[model samples]
Target: MQRLQAFKYELMPNGEQQRNMRRFAGACRFVFNKALALQKDRQAQGEKKLSYAAICKALVEWKQQAQTLWLNETPSQALQQSLKDLDRAYSNFFAKRAAFPRFKKKGQRNSFRYPQGCKIDQANSRLFLPKLGWLRYRNSREVLGEIKQITVSHHAGKWFVSIQTEREVAQPVPQGGIVGIDMGIARFATLSDGSFIAPANSFKRHQAGLRKAQQALSRKTKFSNNWKKAKARVQRLHARISNVRKDFLHQATTAISQNHAIVCIEDLKVRNMSKSAAGSAEQPGRNVRAKAGLNKAILDQSWFEFRRQLSYKLAWQGGHLIAVPPRNTSRTCPCCDHVSADNRRTQARFECVACGLDENADVVGAINVLRAGHARLACEVNAEVMASAAGTHRGDLAA
Candidate 1:
């Protein structure tokens, strides 16, 4: 099976290299925004808008003749590809997969990636690029198999490189165990085996520091050096929260994938569910304070990220990750298939009105997921066998 894997490394670049990286990122961003503006202007004037290739030509001209300052800096083809990425993003938005392309704000930007023409050789802990020469990397994890491409990115005022590679898939290790997992804000996840992973609430733990940093940033004059420093501080806090959440997800997914041959979960519409309504004196949930805190906490649960990790990891391990349509899964009783919204009296309690079976609400959800998985498995097996028989019958007829 073909799979894409990324190996991330922390970069140890000197002052000049760091400055060059920043300049390249700035130049790419400048070209993209300028091209977008030019395109919009031409459209407004009823003229033919510039194509991506045309915009790239303009960037080349600027680099060569107009601005000889960055002439020695040397531009990469990857920089040109950034504009294409922006175009694709806008295209996706038009196709309704994403929101309208937002003009990237200076301070709010995290990092840019060298999506093309980059190389990494972990054996030497060095990365080569179009402009910058081979730079040393602080690689901790072993780069698996053969390298394909390397991407340079920055986060929390720190530089990092990601190496994408391809490798032979490992042989499947039999676990013989199956599990159903229910993810929620209150308890993170509850499994079919009646075990639960408690919510870490990493954001909540670091909220005070983040808020203070943001406040400090707000007080700093915009575009000033102090503002930049404060902004970096805030970004560092955000990065800490993200790191904590990612670590938790990695550990949890690894544990589940290792122990379970088949893992079932709900296909939750997290984005829809996470949407907030305005709260007033009468509509309390939609109020600013309530919505901000509650929604932030729920989003920090990172259900989507957890599901995403489980998906690829399980596939790599030859384990199955099953998602069931999330219809009345929590309301229905696993034992008797009794469905009632009132079955859940409280967030933690689930008492089936018909079967009179009491259990943890999350456990009930897990069991329902397991049943759904089993039903799907049976259907798939039957479909495969039927297809096989049909193929054999056709062969016999041809004979």
Candidate 2:
């Protein structure tokens, strides 16, 4: 089986190389925003959207123009790749998979991708880009497989390189029985086997420091050196919080994926759940402050990232991840199969009104999810069997 993976490492570029990388990132951002604006203009004029080739032609024209001649200094291929990214974004929008493409802003996710023209010398711990000469990177781990693409990104005052590679490996044989998980604020994840993971709460732990930094930043004059320093402090704090949460999630997901052949979880729409409680101008919302705090906690937990990691990791390990509809997983009683909102009178406790089965609310939810996943998997297998039988019968009739 073929597997694709990305290896990331911090880059140790010289002063000139750092300046060039920044300029390249800025050029890519400019090209993306300019291309997006052109698309918007075309749409507003009731004209068809420009195809990728048409946009590439426009890019050439922009380069030739006198005012934007500096764009020539940046890697042409990198600029074209930025336009390709916009095209992909538009594709996602038209397919209803994502929101409309938005203009890129400076200093946020500054990056450039190289489809080709990159050389890596792991022995020397350096890689070569098209415009930027050989740059040193911290070779934390040996890179595997053939390089597919390279992405250079700036984050938290550091430059990093991500090398995506492809390789072949033996298909994994899944092990262990199926289990269900209940994700929550108090407990990060509760398993059907009566085990639970504690919440990382990285942001909550550092919220006070972040608030103080922001307060100091607000007091500084705009564009002052002190303001920039304070802003960097805030960014670094955010980066630390993110790194802590990511490390925790990686460990938890890896353990679950390795041990469980099948994992079931509720199909939670985290975006909708974390939406702001503030209402429109005509209608105000109650408990806005409480809801805001709840939303922050939900985002901090990174539930969506958890599920995403599980999905791919399970596939890699020949395991399965099932997401059952979250209609009544929490309210239903696992003992009597009775469904009622009254069963969950509080957040932590669950007591069935009909059969008097008592358990933790999260545990009950996990139990129901496990049962639902069993039924769902059974239905899928039966459907496949039936389809195979039907195809065989048709072949016999034709013979």
Candidate 3:
């Protein structure tokens, strides 16, 4: 089996190299924004949007032009990559996978990719790119597999390189254990086997400090040195919180994926669940503030990230992940199959009115999810068997 993975490391660039990188990133951003503007103008003028090839042709002209000759200083490949990214963004928009491409902003997620001509010197912890050569990085882990592409990004005033590689590995054999997971704000995840993972609430833990930093930033004059410093502080804090949440999710997902051959979880619609409760002007929403706080808490849990991590990791481990409908999972009784709004007496407790079986609400939810997953798997097996039998019967008839 072949797998693709990315290894990221913090880059240590000299002053000249750092300046070049910043310029390259800026040039890429400029190209993307300029191309988007051109596309919009052409659309307004009743002309078809420029294709990637056309944009590249225009880019070559722009680099040679007297006014925009500075574009020539950056690597031509990086500029072409920016055009490719814009094209992809447009494609995604047309496919309804994402919103329309927007103009790139300065100092926000500055990055440029090197599709080819990237070399790694692991022994010396150095990386070489097309134009920027011999950049040192902190080799936290060994880079595995054949390198395909490299992306350099600036985040929280730090530069990093991400190397994507493809490698062949033996497919893992299923370990034959199945578990269902119930995710919530109180506990991160509750398993059908009665084990639970606690919520880290990383954002909540750092919320106060972040709030203070933002307040200080607001007090500083706009575009002042102090304001810039304050903004950096807030960005660093946000980055720290994100790192903590990601680390916690990865650890939990790895454990769950490794332990279970089949993992079932609720198909949660997080966007709808976290939408603001504020209503139209004529019809005011009640408990708007309470709903807002609940939305924050729900987002803070990072349920989607947990599920995403579990899915890919499970696939890599030769396990299966099933998403069952979330409807009535908490209300349904696992022992008696009784489902009622009143069955969930509180957030943490569940009691069936039909058979009077009581259990933890999350645990009951996990059990119901497991049952649903089993039913789905059984149906799939039955269908496959039926298809095979039908094929054999058809063969006999032909004979």
Candidate 4:
């Protein structure tokens, strides 16, 4: 099957190239913001919003109006690609495929993506752009498939290039056994076969430095050079946290996918589950002032991203990903179908009232997820059989 994938490589750029890239990214951001503001104003005034064609025209006019704006760091196709992205984002939003466009704030944006021509080669780790010369890259992994598009962005004060590719991935059924997974903030993930992946709070480990960087950023005056530097420090720290989380997810997902023919997991609404209530004025969840800090830690778990990756990776490997409904999977006893919130007294302990079976809460959830998956499979089989019989009867009547 054909799949779209990306290969990201760190860029080795001199000061000049780095500055140029920054300028290009800034220009793109400026155009997007300007267009969005204009669009909003037009809406308020009851005028038709400017389409991308109109925006592209404005960009051409602006580029011609002042060479100084784009002189140091303008790619020929970059601005055009940016306009396309704005259009696409709005299109997706209007189609209800994505959330509405949010204004891009300074220092919060990290990436920009644009289209590429056919001259790019993933094997050689080289790309030829309109004005930019044949740029060589230091690739960390082998670029897996055909290059579709390329995006160059800065993260952690470093520039990197990502090549989107399309390739045919062979999905062969595995010989391994089936397993079910239950994901939670307390224990990351628990498998049906009794194996568990513990939550390694990478954010917690790096919170001290992150807090220091954030505080330093907050103290600096807005729009000042010092503030920019401090903001970069904060960005770098966040990038580190993201990298750590991604690495952990990749490792866990690979281990689970490789060992299982069928993987079942709870379809949890993580956003709803991550909320913590307010306590008395004396004591909050962690510290009253640190409410946002604690919340960030919970959000950083990236449970949703984990499930997304597991779904596709397992599909690509010819394994199944069964997302059972988020019923009382934690409290329901897989052995006897009993469900009660009281069954779970602590984060670690689970005692079933119906069956008297005791197990880890996460393990119980995993077992329940597996049972749900099995039940779903059986129901699907029966449905198929009924459909077949119905079709046969209809054919006989027609005859």
User: Which candidate order results from sorting by lDDT in descending order?
Assistant: 2, 3, 1, 4
Task: Tell me the tens digit of each residue's lDDT in model 1 across 299-364.
Answer: 999999999999988887889988999899899988888899989989999999998999999999
Give the per-residue Cα lDDT of candidate 1 at 243: 96
lDDT of each: 0.82, 0.95, 0.93, 0.79
Q: What are the models' TM-scores?
A: 0.89, 0.97, 0.97, 0.86
In terms of lDDT, the best-performing candidate is 2
Per-residue lDDT for 360 in model 4? 87
Candidate 4, 1-399: lDDT as tens digits: 788888788877667667667777887777777778878888899998788889888777777766445632567577777777888988999999999787777655555565766366557777665455566788667877877777888777777888888998775776577778888767788888888888878888898999999988889999899998898888878888889999999998888787787888888787775666566688755554566555666676888989998887787777888888978888888778877998898888999877788888888888888888999978889999999999999999999
Q: Give the TM-score of candidate 2.
A: 0.97
lDDT by residue (tens digit), candidate 2, 1-399: 999999999999999999999999999999999999999999999999999999999999999999999999999999999999999999999999999999888889999999888999999999999989899999999999999999999999999999999999899999899999999999999999999999999999999999999999999998899999999999999999999999999999999999999999999999999999899889988899999999999999999999999999999999999999888999999888899999999999999999999899999999999999999999999999999999999999999
lDDT of 3 at 108: 93
Error of 4 at 139 (Å): 1.8
Instruction: State the lDDT at 366 in candidate 4.
Output: 88
| lDDT, candidate 3, at 306 | 86
How well does model 4 score by local distance difference test? Answer: 0.79
lDDT of residue 286 for candidate 4: 55
By lDDT, is 1 or 4 better? 1
